[model samples]
Target chain A: MTDATDFAGSSREKWTGFSANQYFICLKGILVREWLRYLSQKERFVSSLVRPLLWLFIFAAGFRQVLGVSIIPPYETYVLYEVYITPGLCGMILLFSGMQSSLSMVYDREMGNMRILLVSPFPRWYLLVSKLLAGVGVSLLQVYAFLAIAWFWDVRAPVAGYFLILPALFFAGLMLGALGMLLSSLVKQLENFAGIMNFVIFPMYFASSALYPLWRVQESSPLLYKICLLNPFTYAVELIRFAFYARIEWTSLVVVLAVTLALLGAAILAYNPARGLTVRKQDMGGSQ
Target chain B: MKLQSRSPETPRTDERAAVAALELASISYNYGQRKALDDVSFSIEPARFTVLLGLNGAGKTTLFSLVSHLFSPRTGRIRVFGQDIDRNSGQALRRLGIVFQARTLDLDLTVRQNLLYHAALHGIGTRVARQRIDELLHAIDLTDRIEEKVRGLSGGQVRRVEIIRALLHRPSLLLLDEATVGLDIKSRATILKDIRALVERDGISVLWATHLIDEVGQADQVLVLDKGKLVADGPVATILSSTGTETINQAFSKLTGITDMNVRGGRP
Candidate 1:
């Protein structure tokens, strides 16, 4: 065996470089751990699917007669209420997942697991991004599960549309997940999670085109329609809605990508140890 | 057995010029208006067992947070070996491992899974990680519990697993903040003995933070922190001799002016 001194020297030299392989392995670690945790909490999986399915079945069923759909860019003919709301429900899954990821972030911080990731040799931004991607990965699974169930309920899209929707869901998931990451940094304690739901989740979901088309909102209240246009969740649903029919909404696509980048950038700054939310929490000895 | 250690590779041609295992110069941190660490400064020599003695709020955890890069100091700098933590955090943190005061293991994950996750975070490949995990579990005598979920393990067993997790990447400096706080006597002794053996056999540098006076050995180097200020830093004998105290307990009491050391360590 090598001398202890010689071994330390060689090992330090070996591990210091930030190679592509190392970054990839780190990401794999985060993803696998997330998947393991997600798999273990079977209730979380069931709930994610259940919430969307309830909206598709019960909520859309009740609204079908009152909310008749007109031909939209993604639709050649008038579609059923359930079919129009399927993508919105997918957006709902992504949105809730983003919030759920935020909740987990708070739990991790309070529980001290966040310390492990923060202290790793990888760059902090990369670690946060990897975590964001992990949440997005889980959201994609939930979205697909919801879509599969929707298909059995007579809400089927084109076969090619199914394949095309993956990228759209992925990008939308990124945007919503980034928003969640930013909210996690802003929320100091786990007890404040209700505030997130009331202030962020509900407002984003309700003011978006997730339930009714923007034109329908424009007819009812032009101000609410303007708010929907401004909501990133609106773009997320529109992007998914367009992709579900094998069409692309370039405006929604651009909005989703740009908002993802902006929110992700903000989340990274908020998590920065020296100047952001973490520093304030540390100032209070992390008690808050 | 292969274990993590440090190389005193920087020759002491001039002692001042040699790279210390860790160096903190005029580091201060604040909690809003309240000061947590008040312009503290100290350094640990490589391959030494250094005890950081402090009462419940002595700012030891705050210092550890700075060293781990969890929170940057409001003023001053921290360096591990020769790498600055703020400017070159990746290189600095790559050489440091920490066992926090709180339990960091994912309770739902098995011991092997938790360690594998940590190993991958440090960029270790799977095969190498598995080999390291096996060797560490064997060394810690927790090999049989490798497949057991962390929640099922005893407190001492969980801590042992955490120690292994910290060592997976073979860090040169290991920091443990109240690592034995809630353990039984036997477990505490066993953990301390194991850590001491690492310093003796593997030549690993350690900064052990504890309020328990009994945990500090007479010959070990010590840093006594008082209310966020570093009050005393030297060998145990040096501190005792300087303060004209007979024991480390008396010396610590004299340095920090805490008369009731017995409260922290029953026999002190």
Candidate 2:
């Protein structure tokens, strides 16, 4: 004879015993949990789709007529500016998308669920990486959706080029995600987030190869051109630009990797429980 | 919930105190130059309800935070069933449950959904998790309102939900830190009765941190705290008898040396 209930109970307990690796597991859980949440918000998908579409339709439409084309590698000759800038705009979208996800971390803190999450028995670093990966996954999906729309237009790249962008996008997303995490770990106040946007966002974009080629900037001003060449976003946009030709830029990939690893490591260090953006207030009494 | 002579060490597995449910030995925590908790030590025994009694700024929450392994302690040890919380926190926390002073339930989730999500975090199987959710709904008197959104619930209802959520994994060492907020008299009594029943059925140990003495007299033991230090700890009867006070209020005031009557009247 079998005690079905008791046996089932033991097995259930055995399963939860695996929660010792809680940080990674909980991070995955939050990913799926928030993914479902993101799905339910019809407005979020609409906005993600619309943001890139507007830039592709309006900004590219106007800029295609003005900017002179340059022979970016893998391009046999000078190509239209629209095709050149599509990946750059996508990079911009992802950069902000990563930061948007970081803002949610601040929101979660105000909600108190963050306390439940951060107090879990898992390693905090793994937990943070899991969250970063989830945000990057969402950003990549939006990028693909934007690319699918681009194919409907005359801006299509080679069929094989689509497959090559995966790793490029991953590292790119990782780099931006690291930046977002660093900002979130440092910026504890919601009111000061706008300060990050004004200071970090536009400067990074205007200084990168997203809007124009590095050579074009050098032709105009040497100092601005040097800043563009040094910017990591330049490497990210360059990765996407090269991948469009169904070829990977090995140098750009290395640069993005180095930057992503260093920034993510820095974010982890800043997020140490002993200091940094840890909760300053403890609830001695119940909810106010 | 049926178990006998539970080992405190392997509480989640054997339903015994496997070791002591929780142990804090010579524990001290510092923030910059200030000490938040100074040499605080206590052990929670199986089936014994212990109340951590203290006032505001008394370092009660700091002690709870250290025990939960939210951050590493500057000095000393925190253990569950003799397992160091830092090194073996996964196994140690598995044996215990905590309801912090803040409301932790996700407002977007229903009562059942909230429990289900927490169970998933703990890696409880879906089938067993569902059954436990239903059991908790009944236990918390929320069976009729299981699907209602948590944001819609009153303060008292949310408190009950937190307790039910904590108990879903059937933790051997349950911690309630000022969990009485927003709860009315009847609701409080109901919650107290349910937890007492759980303690009797499984001999589960509990450490409830609270400022009020009335709601906690049922505790088997009481640890009196003043500032960041342990002032007294013993059986409830013994503590009250030695303090020479009729109630927890008079006793608390007599010990703390601050005889402000207004603070005492707020106790129900």
Candidate 3:
């Protein structure tokens, strides 16, 4: 013990050093809180699932005859449009949940709950990553719920694919959640999330291979195809798609992992107290 | 200037050198082009209620933000109980507890839930946390309200719950930034009384920030901030005598050059 701790007495003993146990406890606390909040707000759960289900049931069904998916690597035979879009719908759940979680973070910031987490004894990066992981956990629940519905609707992958997709969903969710955190750090107000939706969410989703395969987009517009290839969401979707078929797209896996690290790094920097978004005047509880 | 005091009468022991509860040295911070805190520095002694007296935009919240590690100062060092905030932030924050001016409790969660989450963040074991929560709630006379959502509580009750949350980990130094801003007079008094009781019973140092003149007790230490600069620092008696004023309100007016307390500052 340092002289300070000894001099400060027994009350200082508990906080003299950091422990791994405390770290895990903090992580669990964050995850459980997010889970509790997610459960309480049934509307959020329903809305997150509803968006993807709508695209799968209505949009995919309508376009089934029109857009015939060819023999893709993940698909050995000709597949119905709904089956082809299942993984994409899962990605859609992750995408929306990521942004939605970020939206709630902005709301938390506005309402001062973010400050509580920021002021915790843990490192800021640890807190942020835990939050990101918690967001992924919540989004995972939504994705599985959607997958379950799709399965009952006759959009079934191999049983092994169900288990294999867990790791893939985790990575995709992490990458998307990190992207959302990055965007959330930059956003000053909750209302500006609309701008994120119109600018970030829509563009990333539409330009990605989430709805249509990259080859299909290339056949239509090479420029849009280039965009699809460049979009991180595309790799995220492809990663989930391949994993769902008990296959691995090494390129997409590498891309998603790389992007997750990059976005998480940037998000950590953006949330840094020394120089980051938290330094904003409004974040300091307004004028005083 | 008698602006800095280290309880000179107390022996210069190694313990005194190693701790000040909270110490800031030449700290300055800016937001865009405007300065929030400029070369402001002070240290609070252990087991004393030090009032950080500042008006609307006198940078009280900015100072709190720096101390809490919410925003790093552009210049200077901040230490809590002799641990530098930047170099040893975890240690620094470990000993420090803060209640921000803004309401931080999650309105949707029950009081126990909010407090337990904070305990977990501090790494306090669940068993110990439950015991502490029960003790604190009983002390605050809110044991009955533990399960009620924070949204359903009265403003004063919510404030008490937040106070309990801040104290859960047994911090050596407590910082309250305008803690009673929007409460009724009675609630404000009760909260202040409870905090003062903590200082006497628990030997915890407190930095209580507020613009209210009445909050400054006669025996408390005072750090008067004006226009982002610490204008004066000393005991209430010293400040009153130093400024040659009969009362703290008059001394505060003289120090800050604001003759009227009712008038708002230029920044709103």
Candidate 4:
């Protein structure tokens, strides 16, 4: 025991201090881990792109002849369906990426690594935010990769719009990522995630203005248009769509921002140790 | 039954200095209608190895969760080194380290990466984190395995890495919740020896939670819980003597009023 004290005392002096810099270190570690995981799983990159490209090339090409899209603000002339849906596909990339990150969060919780993150002295909000930021970072990379592919496919945004869209992409990614975080807190098991993709991912994508313009939906059915207007995913897609044209979609921006903040607040509450959705039956011994 | 007196070295006086490394005062937790811990109260001294002995569903994990702030007690207060866990959780948690009952390492990550990430969370700089990691790995005789991914490591090896991850920030109090649950006898013994050595040599207070009676030593302090209630708490010899039993197994059976072999098996 004396030896233990002696060793600790001497050893303690070599590395013993805490500072704000550690926050960045933690954030860096999280981002690096995400990057490493992304790098290792080349299939994820391919899959993420494949979904959007399928929509752009296959669905867009097929719909081009069938659908008549009026010249949207960003487009000076009547555009091909592929050109119109490119930004929507960008939104899709973010949506799936966000959900994928949350899937990992659920996995982390089940596997006990989430406990490691929660136990850190930092505020839970900070940890959750870091996770969101890392997810957003990854999702943004995927978005740009998709965009670069689109560029080669002759669906080019203005050169400046490509750079200008970064902030829009970030905010959209954050909102979707935050929503995913909230869902992860509510979801108790991995088996339930497939249900989320079905109920959340598919509905949000199809019901929103991602595929067809809201007016077109209104012309076909006013009720579906009303639902599309209410869907936050609509705003996310609109934000990206407008960004690609170097145009400001204030309504979309405001809606996405509001949804992001609300979902973020709800997520923090859901993850709260005292009264959050994370309170589990296993944690409390039989209580759900 | 006459309760034995406190050890002479036990600091029970000077209220401020004797606040204990960890303390739970009237702590109670519930899962909706079901009570997980009922008015549990205890305190552990610094530099001592206190074994929290309990059977399955005895609220051991619940208690650990509360202490780690994963779940806050609906009633009562928990303090770490006199810092209130609820009111001052950041400070309290800063002095604490924990290895949960479940496996926590990211299997894809290298040993060094896992530890370094934890170090960064505690706000330890990279340079200092690297130095501490090196020393701890050396201490654990895992210096050569630093670059190896956690998935390649054996269960016992991963547990060792988790322990090292917990200690990287030099937390004053270390908690292990059923850390040896799945390990072989040799691995369990090695871990137990290493942790006990930490207390004896480094003066780091330890709260080792498990149901295994064999893990409790005569010199060690024991806090026994049964069915979410604190049944007995004292030195091992004192608990045995007070119960009028020859061994801890018999004493635990006597205290809990359960004679079933399966209940006393401590297999899980």
Q: What's the distance in Å from true for residue A212, model 1?
A: 0.2
- In CAPRI terms, model 2 is classed as acceptable
By lDDT, the best candidate is 1
- On DockQ, the leading prediction is 1
Candidate 3: regions farther than 4 A off: A1-16, B1-18, B264-268
Instruction: Judge candidate 1 at residue A284 and give its lDDT.
Output: 31
Greater lDDT among 1 and 3 belongs to: 1
* Model 3: how far residue B126 lies from native, Å: 1.6
DockQ of each model vs. true complex:
0.48, 0.33, 0.45, 0.35
Residue B196 lDDT in model 2? 70
> Considering only N, C-alpha and C atoms within 3 Å, which residue pairs clash in candidate 3?
none
Cα lDDT of model 3 by residue, A69-151, tens digit? 99988889988889888888898899999999899899999899998998887898999999999999999989999999999
Q: Best to worst by DockQ, what's the order?
A: 1, 3, 4, 2
CA error at residue B200 for candidate 1, angstroms: 1.3
* Residue B195, candidate 3: alpha-carbon lDDT: 85
Q: Number of clashes in model 2?
A: 11
Give chain A TM for each model in order: 0.93, 0.87, 0.95, 0.91
Comparing candidate 2 with candidate 4, which one achieves the higher lDDT? 4
